[model samples]
Target: MTYEIALNKAWDKIAALASSKKYTVKYFTDIYEVRISDRMMLSISSDTPASEDIAILVLHYLTGFLKYGYNPKEEWISFKDIKGGQSYYPAYQENTIKPILEKFKEKTDDLISYLTESLEGRIVKGGDVTVELPTFSDVYIRMVLWHGDDEFAPEVTILFDRELTEIIPSEDIAVLLFNLAKRISDEL
Candidate 1:
């Protein structure tokens, strides 16, 4: 399967796993979105907007949490920074982040497992352009994960270290950064 096909498949898998409202921009070709919500907690997107890609999942949370929502063009501080620097996510938000973090963990783990099963670690190339997996799938997959170099950015580098990017992308590195809008709505 091609990356585009794999990407699309990834979308279907996640949507199946997450039971929530799904939306589409229409303007973007074939690009669809899924808005996950749990009545007892939060909606992945405050507006319930989602993209077919997981990057949309990450984007939904990062900017949506702000009282006024985050602007797309602006730079943002990821969850790791917030977690690392006591100054990022204030103490008052601790309880709020707990469950969402758990959900994020669950979603992240689900994707990783799905990819390992589907990809079989036998191919490293994207989409239809394929390459055979070396004798060591573990080591080969890890190398594929480390495509970019920006070590000082611990938030970005560490994931490739764990072979997450092999499954997910750099855009949605940590699930914690995602906004649990459904959770926020449920609280209200």
Candidate 2:
């Protein structure tokens, strides 16, 4: 379906459940707000409209959250490990991983600084530079980067909470990562 159709459908689903006791008690409001990145916020309400791509992603997340509830297992896994993630890996690599590698390959320290200072990410072990960036309340994305040598090319790896697919489908996950990489690589 087109993004507009999908967004409207998703919004309708969320609106249908807005008055439920479970929604009010757990969420505390019919209007829901989600952080798309440090620079953007997606509000799920009739009066607040967002770009179609962003609206679809936020609505899908809200729908999933209200239906399944949040229960992150804290275990991190690669994109390929997510259900149907393999099918989207090529695009994810090109759109999400390649840009980040190109942007930070020669400036690893700057990348580290940006993550910690601007994105509020925390340094973690594993790669030359690894950071756990919180994208939402209790939801995070782990980014691991290895600077290139004469013989090897720079590489970046992104990991998500094991339970992330419970809240975001595989396709939207690609979009989410692409948006994140764009934000990170964009001139700041």
Candidate 3:
């Protein structure tokens, strides 16, 4: 189905599930907020071009929550750990990791600074440059970058929380990583 159609369907599902699940819709001037039962579940802004994608992702999260409940397991897991992940290894490396490595080959520090300062990421004590970043209210992704010199080429690896597989589709996980790489690589 087209993204627009899928999004509309998502909205319908969201509304129905929200009512049955007692999720209260909190009105915001520029954003949408949903309170599931008592706890606030999602807050997404409508002022950006990516708002549609955000809404769709939020719907995915809500549906996943309804299906699996909250797993709460925070173990860091690589792409290989995700379902059917191994089959997409080449695409993941080419589409996500390679670009990051290329962009930050000589400017690893700058990327690190941007992620830490601008994105509110925390530097982890590992890799040449390892950071833990929260891309959404409920999603935390880890990135490990290894800068190369004369001998070796630069490399990057992205890992997701173990619960992420249970929260969103694997393809969406790749999309999130791609968005993150673009944000990090874009001239600022």
lDDT of 1 by residue, 127-146 (tens): 22222221111222111122
Instruction: Residues 28-87, candidate 3: write the lDDT tens digits.
Output: 122345544433335455432335665576677666676676555768888878888899
lDDT score at residue 68, model 1, on the 0-100 scale: 30
* TM-score of every prediction relative to native: 0.20, 0.80, 0.77
**Superior candidate under lDDT, 1 versus 3:** 3
| lDDT per residue (tens digit) for residues 1-188 in model 2 | 45767766776776665444232111212243543222223345554545678767666776777788779897889999988888878888888888888778767788888878877789889787789887755678899888868998888999988888888888888887888887778843
* Sort order, lDDT high to low: 2, 3, 1
Question: What is the full ranking by TM-score, best candidate first?
Answer: 2, 3, 1
Q: Candidate 3: TM-score?
A: 0.77
lDDT of each: 0.32, 0.72, 0.69
Q: Comparing 2 and 3 by lDDT, which wins?
A: 2
